[model samples]
Each structure stands twice: as structure tokens, then as C-alpha cells.
Target chain A: MPYVNVKITNEGATPTQKAEVIAGITELLQRVLGKNPATTVVVIEEVDTDNWGIGGEPVTLRRRRGL
Target chain B: MPYVNVKITNEGATPTQKAEVIAGITELLQRVLGKNPATTVVVIEEVDTDNWGIGGEPVTLRRRRGL
Candidate 1:
């Protein structure tokens, strides 16, 4: 079984967009690894800007600083 | 910075339970790997039984057959 997890910044992704992401990831895995779609699990998690950071600064703060 | 993704079978996990999972994972990473909690991200995703399978049979079907 292939379990794919995707993390997208909380930029207000709609339901349709999320569905497409799941479908696309599943298709990619199937085409590349010949994995069965039935056994493939694709999960998308939208994280808060404050909880996600890079370069020792939260995304929220980084955005405020124009970085 | 560490990003942790947790996938759990959708057996009606409550918000409290999910929180615990997130917290526990963050703590484990901090204790073992010395990851900073502020930059650590933990996301939990629940998968449907019908979409999750093992041995070429969906989990839902396996449950029905008591397998």
C-alpha cells in the first residue's frame, strides 16, 4: 500500500482543488510505480501559517516582513 | 525543522484524540531528534475504510467477513 501525504499552506484551497490534488497524486503513483489505486491513500493537510516555518521564522512573520 | 504526517484509519477519531497524536509526535521528535517544536509541523489524516485495503481486499469488505 502506498500512502501519500501532501502538506499545503492554508491559502484557502477549495474542496474541488483538494479533490484534484488527491486524484493527481494517486494517478502519478499508479503511473510511476504501478501501484493499485484501490490501495493507494492520498491525504492533503492544510497547515496554519503560524504553525509552519522556514529559516527559523513562521510563514506568517516571513510574509509580514516581505520575505 | 521537522514535518510529521500521521495517517490513521477512520475509526471515528475525536478532536481530542487527534490532538494527542499531534502532541505526542512533536514531543517524540523533540526528545529523540532534538527538533524544535516551533518549527515542527504535525498533521493527521483519516482515511476511509473502503479506500484502504490489504491483501487486495478493502478494509470494509474484510470487516464484513470478520477478517
Candidate 2:
């Protein structure tokens, strides 16, 4: 069993995209570690860009710079 | 910052395996969200079979059942 928590800056990701990501991560665990996908839990949390930072700069600023 | 926490059942995972998982997650964030890897934090937690629960049963019991 695995509990995977992924926090991504809330830029712009469709629900479909997030669902695909969750499925991909679950598949990764099953294929690489032989983990059962039935018991795996994947939670995706979208953090506000203001709360997310990169290299000490807020993600909002980075996004504005096209980074 | 993107904090990715992965909790895997501590049945059998080498240091090398954990490293690969961490690296893969970091790359995923960078590629998907354009988040800088330098600010991404990936922590792999080894969950004891006794503590991890799945399908309303402890992982230890589930493992014994080959689930």
C-alpha cells in the first residue's frame, strides 16, 4: 500500500490532467514496486501560487516571467 | 514549493530504489508544472506494515493475504 500526496502550484491544470497524473503515479508504483493499485491512495493538492515558491521566489512571480 | 510525500510499505525497498522514486517525482514536477527542482522537496516515508491500512485492514494482514 502507498499513500502518495502531490502538491502542485495552482497554475492551470484541468481535472482530466490531474486524474491522468494520479493514474500514472499509481501505475508507476504497481509496475516498479509491485504494489497493489487497489489499496494505493493518491491525493493531489493544489497550492496557491502565492504559497508556492521556487528558489526563494514565489511561483506567481516565476509564472509571470514565463518560467 | 512543491512538497511531494510518498509513503510506501516498508516491505522491500533499497536505498537505490528510493533515490529513483525521488528523482522521478522531482522530474515530474519540473516537467509537468515547470516547477524548479531546486525548490522541490521529495520525501519518501517507509510505512510499517502494522501502521499502513488498506481496505479497512492493516497492511500486514493484507500482505499475508497476498493483497
Top candidate by DockQ: 2
After best superposition, candidate 1 residue A48: deviation in angstroms?
10
What value does the lDDT take at residue B42 in candidate 1? 65
- Tell me the tens digit of each residue's lDDT in model 2 across B27-55: 76676566678878888888888997766
| Model 1 lDDT on a 0 to 1 scale | 0.75
Listed per model, the TM-scores of chain A against the true chain A are: 0.90, 0.89
Error (Å) of candidate 2 at residue A38 is 2.8
Question: What's model 2's lDDT at A66?
Answer: 85
Judged by whole-model lDDT over C-alpha atoms, candidate 2 comes out at 0.80
Deviation in Å, model 1, residue A18 alpha carbon: 9.0
What does candidate 2's lDDT look like per residue over A1-67, in tens digits?
A: 6889998877687787777777877877777678789878889899898887667888788878987
User: What lDDT does each candidate get?
Assistant: 0.75, 0.80
**Candidate 1: clashing residue pairs, number:** 0
A1-67, model 1: which lDDT tens digit per residue? 7998778779899999999988998899899999999999988878766545444445666678886
Kindly give the stretch of ten consecutive residues in candidate 1 chain A with the minimal lDDT sum: A49-58
